[model samples]
Target: MYLLSKALIFPPVTEADDDGLLAIGGDLSVERLILAYNSGIFPWFNQGEPIIWYSPSQRMVLFPNELKISKSMRQIIRKGTFSITFNRHFKEVISNCKQMYRPGQGGTWITDEMEQAYIELHKKGIAKSVEVWQNNSLVGGLYGIDLGHVFCGESMFSKVSNASKMAFIYLVQKLEKENYKLIDCQVYNNHLASLGAKEISRDSFINYLNKV
Candidate 1:
C-alpha cells in the first residue's frame, strides 16, 4: 500500500475525482490543494516534482472524544514544560517536520515544493498549524487544512520525546472544545493507532465525511 501510495500511477485524477488517482501533474496551488482537502484527496509527491493526489481505500481518523493520552503521556502533559500555540511559524514547522529522522526511513516526502505550497495555504488561512515549544525552542508541530468543521491533518513532526504526541493531544482537546467533529488523519499506520486513530472503510469514511 505504501509503495503504491508513494508513486504516480497510470491515470491522472479528474477534479474532485475520488475514483483512483487525482491529477498526477498538478501544481500545489492553494486553490487546487484546498479543493482536494475538501474532497478527501491530498498531494504527496517528493521534492522537485509536480504534485500528485491520493485517495486511499480507507481513511484513518480520530474522533475528538477518542484521543488516548497514555498514562506516560498524561504525565508528560502534567509536567507543563511545553507550550503550544496555533498558526505560529508554519513554514518553520514544515521545515522542522522534514528534518526529523525516522528510524529505518530513507527519505521524507514533505519536499521543498510541498512545504512552500503549504506556506502559501497558511497565508490564505485555508491551512492551520499547532506548534509546541520547549525551553524557547520549537520541539513539535503539525499542519493541516480547515474545512468548515473538519480539519484534514497533513503531517506532523517532533524534535523532542513525546513532543508530537503532545501536539496531537492538544489538537484533540482544542477540537473537542470547539465542537469540531473529526480530524481526518488520511491513512493507517501503527503510530497513529497508538494515539487512538483508527481505520474506517472508504465507504464508512466518506459517510462520516458527509456527516461532517
Candidate 2:
C-alpha cells in the first residue's frame, strides 16, 4: 500500500489494488479531498483507523436520463407529502447520516475530521446536500461533492420510509434538468441499483471525471 506524505498529491487511480485501495494515511484537507473526488477517488475508513483511499475497478453510477422512478415513488412525489431543498441544513443532514443505522454495520464512517472537512468543502461551494422535509421538520436527506457535470454521492439517511428516496429522486430530476452527465455512486449497492445505478469500468468513470 502506498503511504501518503504531507504533499498534496495522489498516485494515479490505475495504481489501486484489486480491492481498489490506492493509498493510506492522508489528511482529509479541503484541497486533498477536492483533488481526490476530481480524480475519481474517495476516502472510506472507520474512526481511529488511518484514512483509506479507494478507486474501484468497477464504478457505480447513474446517468440522469436513466433514473428510474417507480409508479409508487411517482405517487409519493405527486402527493407532495415531502419537500426538497438544496444546500439547506447540510450539517444536520450529514449529522443524521452519521448517526443512521445500517443493518450489520457497527458504526459510521463519517468521523469528526471527515465531517469538518466536508463542511469546509460546503463552505467553498463544492459539497452539496439535499434535504427532505415534512411539515417543516427534516425527515431525510443526502449529501455529496458536486463537480459541475458529475455528482459524487457520499451518504444519505432517512428518518421515515421513502424519505431518503424522495431526496435522491428530487436530486436526479434537478440534475437532469441541468443536463448533468451522471451521479457517481462509488460502488454497487442494491438500493442504488433499484434507482438504475449500474457499474462501469473505472477507466470509463475516470473519463467522466476528466471532463469536470
Candidate 3:
C-alpha cells in the first residue's frame, strides 16, 4: 500500500490491495477528504492507527429506486413514530455515532480527528446528517458525505429499536425525491443488505461517481 505524505494525493484505486486498502498515513484535511470521496476512496481506520484509505473491488451501494422497507418499518413510518430532519445537529449526530456500541465491535473508527474533519466538511456544505427524533428526543441519526448525486454514508446510530432504520428509510426517500442516484455504504453487511443495498463492482461504482 502507498504511504501518504504532505502531498494531498492518493494512489490509483486499481492499485489497492485485494481487501481494498490503498494507502495509509494521510491527514484528514478537507481538501483530501473531498478529493478522496470524489475519486471513490475513503478513510476507515481504527483509533490509534494511521489513516487508512480503501476502495474495494466490490462496493456496497443502494440505488434510490432499489430501497426496501419491510412491512413493519412501513407501519412504523405510516404511524409517524419518528420525526426526521436533515442537516440539523450534525455534531450531535456524529458524536452519537462515535459512541454507540456495535454488537460485535469493541471500539469505534470515528476517531476525534475524523469527527472534527467531517464536522468541518459539514460546515462547508459537503457533509450532511439525518436526525431521527422520537418525543422530540434525538434517538437516532446518521451522517455522510454528499457528493451531489452520490452520498457516501459514513456511520449511523440508534438509541431506540428501529430508530436508525427509520432514519435510513427517510433519508433514502428524501434522496429519491432529489433524484440522487446512489448511497455509498462502503462495505457489505447483512444489516444494509436487508435495506436493499447490493454489491457492485468497484469499477461500476466509479463509473457512476464519474457521471455525478
10 residues in a row with least lDDT, candidate 1:
1-10
Task: Please give the range of 10 consecutive residues that has the lowest summed lDDT in model 3.
Answer: 101-110
C-alpha lDDT values of all predictions: 0.78, 0.94, 0.95
Candidate 1, TM-score vs. the true structure? Answer: 0.86
Q: List, in order, the clash count of every candidate structure.
A: 2, 0, 0
**Stretches of candidate 2 above 4 Å error?**
none
Say which prediction, candidate 1 or candidate 3, comes out ahead on TM-score. Answer: 3
> Number of the top candidate by lDDT?
3
Per-residue lDDT for 53-143 in model 2, tens only?
Answer: 9999999999999999999988988899998899978999999999999999989999998899899999999999999999999999999
TM-score of 2: 0.98
Worst 10 residues of 2 by lDDT: 203-212
RMSD (Å) per prediction: 4.9, 0.7, 0.7
Task: State the TM-score for model 3.
Answer: 0.99
What clash pairs does model 2 have? Answer: none
Q: Rank the candidates by lDDT, best first.
A: 3, 2, 1
Give a tens-digit lDDT track for model 3, residues 1-212.
99999998899999999999999987999999999999999999898999999999999999999999999988998899999999989999999999999988879999999999999999999999999999999999999999999999999999999999988998899999999989999999999999999999999999999995
